[model samples]
Target: MKHFATALLCGLTLAWISTVTADQKPNVLIITVDDMSCDSVGAFGCELAETTPTIDALAASGMRFHYAHVQVGNCFPSRNVMFSGRYPHNTGVEGFYQVRDTQYAHLVDAMKDAGYYVAIRGKVTHSTPYQPYAWDQDLTIIDGQKQHIKNADSYYRSTKLGIQSAAEANKPFCINVNVSDPHKPFYAMSSKGQVVKDDNVPSKIFTADEVPIPGFLFDHPDVRKELAHYYSSVRRADDCVAAVLKALHEAGNEKDTVVFFLSDHGMPLPFAKTALWHHSTRTPWIVRWPGVTTAGSVDRQHMISAVDLMPTLLDILDLPAPNAFDGSSFKPLLEGGAQPGRDVVYKVYNENSGGNRSPMRSVETKRFGYIFNPWSDGKRIFKTATQGTMSYRAMRTVASSDPVVAARLQHFNHNVLEEFYDYQADPDALHNLIDDPQYQKEIEELRAEMRRFMVETNDPILAAFDKRHDLAAVSAYVDQVQAESDARRARKRTNKSPQQDDSLFRLVVPKQVQAGQAVLVKIRHTLPKAMAEQQFHVTLKNGDGGRVERIVKTASGDGVLEIEFDVPANLKTKSVVVSAFVGPEYGKHHLHRTKGGIAVTQP
Candidate 1:
C-alpha cells in the first residue's frame, strides 16, 4: 500500500509539464448522466412533457453532436471507456464496478502529467477509484461515513473550488463532475420536493399511460408510468447541467470550456439497461464546444460510440491521443469537416445487477448492426428484463393468474440467449436477423467482423471458449462445485441447484475508501448450470488477524454480486489480500487463481 502511494507521490514532479501558456487550449468540463436516452430531450424531438430548457440551451449555446453515442451502455463499461480512453471491449470490463484494470492510464493521471488541475465532482466510474491515481486532495466524508456523498451540488461546488484553487495556484484545470443523483431511483429531488428516506419515490412521478413507449419494450401502462418518471429524472439532471454551464459562464470560462453531457447507457429496465441492443448501448450525446463545433448542427449520418471520448478529447485539446486508446478521433466531424463513418463500433454486455447474466457482442456501423450469438438457446436475450423492475406485489399478481407470465417470471430468474439485429431497416430492432436465410450474406459478413474483433482484442472469454463445445467438460467441473455445494448444505445451506463452473472473480478496494467503510468486491459468473441450492462466500485477509467475510446466495442463474463492509481503523493503508471460497467443512475446492493484493484509496 505504501509502495504504490510512494510511487505516485514520488512521481508528482514528472506528472505534469505546465501548458498554461497555451491560450488556444480550451478548458474541459465533462458531465455524465445515467440511464438516459437520446430521445428524452426537446432538442432530440422528445414527445414527452418534460422541461429541459437548460439542456436545450446548452445545445443552442454550443454545438450539438446528434450521432454522439456511448461505447458500452452499461454504467461501469461506459464510464471505463470514457475515463480510460479505451474501448470497453478492449479494457476487458463489463457491467458492475468490480472488474479492476489497474494497468491502464486514466485521464486524471494523463491530464495531471500534462500540467492540468484535475478536479472531479460527482462520479465517473474509475474516477475516484477507492484506490488512487492522481487527485490532489480528498473531500470531507459526508455524515461521518467513510464514503463521500454522491450529490449534484457537491459536484458543482467541488468543480468551482477546484477551478478557483487551480487558477489561484496558477495551473490549467480539467475538472469532471459526476452526478449519480438522477440515476436509478433519483435521489436529487429532495431540494425540489419533500424529502423522503427511500430513493424509490419519484421526483416527478408520472403515469405509464403518459409515456410514449419505445418500440423495443413491451407496452404496459405501468411501464409507461415508469417511463414518465424516468423523464422526470432527466429533467432533474438538466437542472444541474444548467447550473454547471452557468458557473462556467459566470467564471468567464464558459467560452473556454469544452463541455460534454452523456449517459452510461439507456434507462434501467427490460430493453434499456443491460443489453447490447440499440436501446441498451446507444446514448443521447450533446457536446457543447465554444469554437471547434458549430451550434445547432446535428450529425445523424456519422456513427460515434462512447469509447471514443478519450481519444476525441485529446484530439480536441490539440494533444496526442494515447495509442492505448482504442477509439479513433472524430474531431473532424465536430469541426464540420468531411464526415467519415467509423469502420466499426464494438460493444459487449455482461452481468446485470444482483448477478443476472446475458452476454452478447455487437459490431455497429452507419448502415448496419451485426450481432454475435455465441449462445443460441431457445429463449430471447431480453425476455427476463422486465422482472428486475417489477415489484414483488406486481410479480405475484401476474404469477397467480397467468402460467405463461409465471413461466416468464421463472425464466426471468435464470439467464439465456444471445441475439443479432439489423439496425438499419429495423432501426428499432423489433426483428432479429440472426437466423433469417435472406440475410445469410449479411450474416457471414458480420460473423467475419465479429471474429476479427475477437482476434484483435484478444478477449479471454472467446479465447478460452473458441471450440470447447460440450456440456460434459462443464458437467465434470460441476461435480467439483457439487462437492462444495454439499458441504455448504451440511452447514444449513438453503440455496440449491446446479452451480456454475465458470465465474471470474476479482477483489476491488478504493484508494480513498476509508479504513472504516466496508470493501465492495464484484464477481462475474456464468451458470452453465443453476445454483438455487447452494451458497457462495468471498473472504479477505491481511497476513493474519484482520479479516472480512461475505456470503452470497442468488436465486438467479447468471449474475454479479457486490459485498460491501467497513474496515477497522487498525487496518490502515491502501492494499489487502483477498480470496474467494465456496462450500463448507474442510473446503473441498478453493479458487486461489489470484494471489494479487487488492488496492485501497487514501484520501
Candidate 2:
C-alpha cells in the first residue's frame, strides 16, 4: 500500500486545517465604557434598581442599540471613531493627535489581518498607532501608580489573562475591555488611599437619596451628591462588564464570542461630557452575536454611529471592509435586518477636553434634535471638565434662587444660536425648539439636513456653517478660515524641520479670551541652526485655577516670537494654559505644550 496512502493523506490534511480554523474564526468582545450613561443601563431604562446587572445581563444576551450615537463627544475623538471606521472629519482625529494615516485600516488592523489575537484592557491612551493596534495583551493603566484593576478581582484577573492569551494563541480573539469605570475621578482608591471595598467593589453605596437627577441636571443637593458618585461609578462599570463576561464563560469562549457593549461618550455630566447633547452623543450599544444576535433584541430601527463600529466589525468577521471606510455595513442592522438608508444622526463638537473651540453641530431626527451653536457668541463661556463638578457647583448655587435653576444655569453658561430639540417631546433637552412656532417645519428640515451633512462631510465647519445667516458674514468667514488654517499649520510646521538635537516649539493663543482682551501670544519656533537667537520663557497658566502669566521673548531671526498679553482686568480665568521655553531654568528648554483651552471670557 504506497506507505498506507501517504500517511492517510497527511491525516486528512491536518483534519481539514483544524476544522477550517475552528469553524471560521469568531471571538471579539470589545466592552469599552468610560464616562458611560445612555440611561445608565438596566436594559437602558435604568431608573435605579440594580443599576445595571452586568449591563442588564449584556442586554439579556445582546442586540440592544436603540439609537446608538457618538461621533465625537470627546474621549480621544470618540475613540478615534471606534478605530477608524472614519469620521472626525475623516480621522484627522478631531482631537488627540497620533494616527499618522496608515491609510485607514485599523479595527485592530482588520482583526490583526484576519488571524485575530489582538488584546488590550483599560483605555490604553485611547488606542493610537501602537503598530496597528499591536497589542497582544496590554492591560492599560493610565498613570495612577499602576497596579490597576479597580475591583471585580482585578477585572477577573485581567479577563482571565486575556482568555489565557487567546487560548494559547490558537487565535480567534480581539478583546479590548477598556472600562475605566464611569470616568471622571470616581471611586477606586486603595494603595493605602482607602475606598475600594470588597466582593468585587460592592459594599452597596449609591445614596444621595437614591440618585436619578438628570433631566439635564439640577435636582440640587449638589445634584444628588454627584448622582451618588455617578451611581457608584456605574457600579464599577457594571463590575467590569461582569468581569469580561465571566472571562467569556470561563474561556470556553462563551459560545464563540462576539460581545461588544459600549459607551465612550456622554455622562461625565454638565449636559453630558463636552455636549453634543442627547445625553451627549448617546451610546449603550450592546450586541452579542452568538447565533447572530436576537436574544432579547431591541434595535429600534437603525441609527448607528461611532462610525458604524468599523464596518460592523468588518461585517461580522467575513472581513473586507476597506474602501477607505467612512462607515457602511450595519451588517443589515446586524442581521435582524432593515437598514433602509438609516435615517439621521450626526453630531460633532470640535476641540474640547480643554483644547477649547466649542464648534458644535447636530442633526438627530427620530422626532428632531437640531443644535448648531458655532461657539454661541454671547461671550463664549462653555468651559468644560463638567465645569468643575458637584453638579456644576450645585447648579451655580441655586442660580439666584432657581427660575428653573436660572434657565438651567443659562443653558450651562451661555449658549443659544439655534437649538430646536423636540426629541420626542423633550428627552431632557428641556425645550429650545429654536423659537418654537411649533418647530418651523422641523426647523427647515433640520436646517436642510445640517446643510446636507455639512456639504457631504468635507466639513471643516462647512465654511462656517455657510456663513450662518450673515453674523457679519459669519465673522468674516470665521476670520478667513482661521487665517488660512493658521497659515497652513504654520507652513506645515515650518516644513517639518527638527532633530539635530531637536527644538520646534509653538504657543499661538486666542481661541477665545475676553476679560479686557489684548491677547496675541505666538512664540512659534524651529531652532537648531545653533539655537537661532534663543531667549524664550513664556508661561501663562490660568486654566481656571488662576494666576501665572510671565513673559520674556526674543527669537525673531526666522524663528518668530510675538507676545502681547494684557487681558487681566479681574481675569478670573476660564482658560489659558500655555508654557514654553529655551533653557536657563524655566522648565529648562521645555519648548511648547498647550493642548487646548485659551478661552478666558467674562469682560
Candidate 3:
C-alpha cells in the first residue's frame, strides 16, 4: 500500500509539472490586414484621425516598428515569406500558384509539433504553400454560418470561437486572423454621396474632402474619392482588430498571449501594390508581448523583414527551427537589444496574380534606395493590378494634355533600366536620380550591395543584373524566362502530360479514365549511368487521397518504362497525378523526378 501511494504521488507531480510547462508557453495571435499601406495606421505616421483607433490603441499598449518591410508586394508571396521564413525564390511561391511539398517546414507545422492548437480565420489558401493543409480548426465557419471576411462582427465571433476551441483542446493557441479590407470593392457610397446599405460596413466612413491623399499620387478629385473609400475600409479593418483583441481579453489570455499585427503589403493602387517601391513593401508592424516589450515603445533603428517572422516566432515558443532559414531570429530586438546588419532591406517582385512577369529587385536604406529592372528594356509595357483602378484611369485621361502627367504615365508603363531615389527627402519616390552625376557614387555603392546580396541568395536574375549594361545579354535572359512562362501556360492549355527540357524526362498518361479503371503511365527518361544501376520509383496519387507506389530497375540509361495503377472504385475527385523518381530506393533521397497529371471521369 505504501508503494502504491508513493507511485501515485510521483505521477501526480509529473502531471502537474507538465500542466505548468504548457501554461507557461505564451499563446500566439497573428492578425494581418490585406492591402493596407504603412501610412494608413495612425501610429505609423498617418495624420488622419480615427483611421485605426483600435490598431493605434494596440500600438500604444505595445511596440510598433517604423522600418518594417515584407519581402514581396503581392498577397500570396508576401504571406508565404512571413510563414516560411524564406524568400519567394527559395519557396517557389513567386506568385499566386500553389507550391507543393517544400523541403522546409511551415510555421503551422512547426507550431503544431510544439503542441499548440493552431487555427486560421481567413486567407487560408494564401497563407499556406499548398492546398488542403491539416489545420486544427478553420474558424471561418462555425456551426452553420460562414465567417464573412469583410464583416467586422464575423471576426469577433470567429476569434471567440477559436479561443474557446483551443481551451477545449487543452493546448496553447496559435491563431492567424487575416482581415480582408482596403483591397477592392471598397465600401461603396451611394451615387448621391451617402453611405450605402450593406451587410459589411466600416465602423466609420470618410468623405472625399477630408481624405488625405498618398504622397505617391497626385491630388486629383478622382484620386481623393478613391482614397476616401480606401480609408473607410481601413477603419473596418481596425474594427476587426478590436474584435480579435477583445476575444483574447475575454478568454483571459491577454497577458499570456503575444499579439502581432501587420499588413500583407501596401494598398492595391498605382505606385504601391505589386511594385518594389518604398511604400510598396513597408508595413505597419506592431507587437504586444506583456512582459518582454515596453508599452508604447517604437523601434526605428532596426529594419525587420517579414522573412524573419517564422524564426522569431519559433524562438519565442522555445521550439527548434529547421536546419536552414533565410531569415534570422529578431528576438533580441524585441527584448530591447540591438542587432547588426539591419540597416538595409532587400525587396523583390516577380510575377503577378495573372502570371505576368515583371521581375524587379531593390535594396533600400533609410535615406536611399536602388532598383534594378532588367525587364524594363524601354519597350515592354508593365502590367499590374493597380492599372485597373480609377486613379490610373484618371491619370490616363489627363496625360495627353499635361506633360508632367504624361511623363509620369510613360515612366509607369515602361520603367527605366535603373532607378535611384533619395527616399528620405522624397518619400513618394517621385524624382529619379539615376542620371544625376552628383549621386552616382551613392548609386554605385548601392549597386555593389545589391550584387552581393543577389550572389549570396543565388537569385535567378543574378546573370541579368551582372550584365545589365549589356542589352543583348539582358534580352537573351528575358527571352529565356518568357519561354519558360509560355511553356507553363501551354501545359495548362493542353491538359496533356509534361515533357521535361532537353528531352531528359517525359511522363504520359491517359487523357481520361473511369473509376476502378486500370490506368497506364508511360515514362521516358535518360538516367545517369550511376542511376541506371539503381532502382526507379513511381508514385501514382488520385485526387481522392489514394496513393499507389511502385519500384522497378532502371534497365538502361535511356529508355521508356510503363506502369499501371488501379483507380479506387470510390474515387471522389476528378484528377490524378503521377510522379517518377530515380533514386536508390523508394521514399529515399531522389536524384531526379518528373511529374504529370491526368483527368478522372466519373463512373
RMSD of each: 14.0, 26.2, 12.1
The superposed Cα distance between candidate 2 and the true structure at residue 2, in angstroms, equals 63
Candidate 1 residue-wise lDDT, 13-125, digit = tens: 12122233456556788877767777777777777765455666566555565555676646666787777767655665554433434666677777777777776654533
Where does candidate 1 stray beyond 4 Å?
1-24, 95-101, 124-130, 137-155, 187-208, 339-343, 353-357, 373-386, 391-418, 463-603
Comparison by TM-score, 1 against 2, better one: 1
**Distance from true location, Cα of 141 in model 1, Å:** 6.1
Ten residues in sequence with the least summed lDDT for candidate 2: 11-20
TM-score of each: 0.67, 0.31, 0.78
Residue-level lDDT of model 2, residues 1-603, one tens digit each, is 223223322321221111124357877788888888888777889898876666776676557888888877878888877887777777766655444655677777677888887877776666653322556556442111133655655666667766765766678788788877777666643322234544445434687898878777756666686677678878877766666666566666666677787898888878888888788888889877777667677988778888888788878778787656666778776668897877787888776644555667898967678888766777768877788777787678878787987888888788777788877778888888687687798799888998888877678777777778767665565455445445645665575534323346666777787777677778667766665567777766554222256787666345667877777666443566666666554323435454346677785
For model 1 the local lDDT of residue 342 reads 61
User: Positional deviation of 241 in candidate 3, in angstroms?
Assistant: 0.8
Model 1 CA lDDT for position 26 = 66
The lDDT ranking, best first, is 3, 2, 1
Candidate 1 RMSD to the real structure:
14.0
Worst 10 residues of 1 by lDDT: 138-147
Off by over 4 Å in 2: 1-31, 36-71, 74-80, 88-109, 112-114, 118-158, 161-165, 178-219, 229-231, 238-263, 266-268, 274-400, 412-414, 417-457, 464-466, 469-603
| Total clashing pairs in model 1 | 35
Deviation of model 3 at 96, angstroms: 1.1
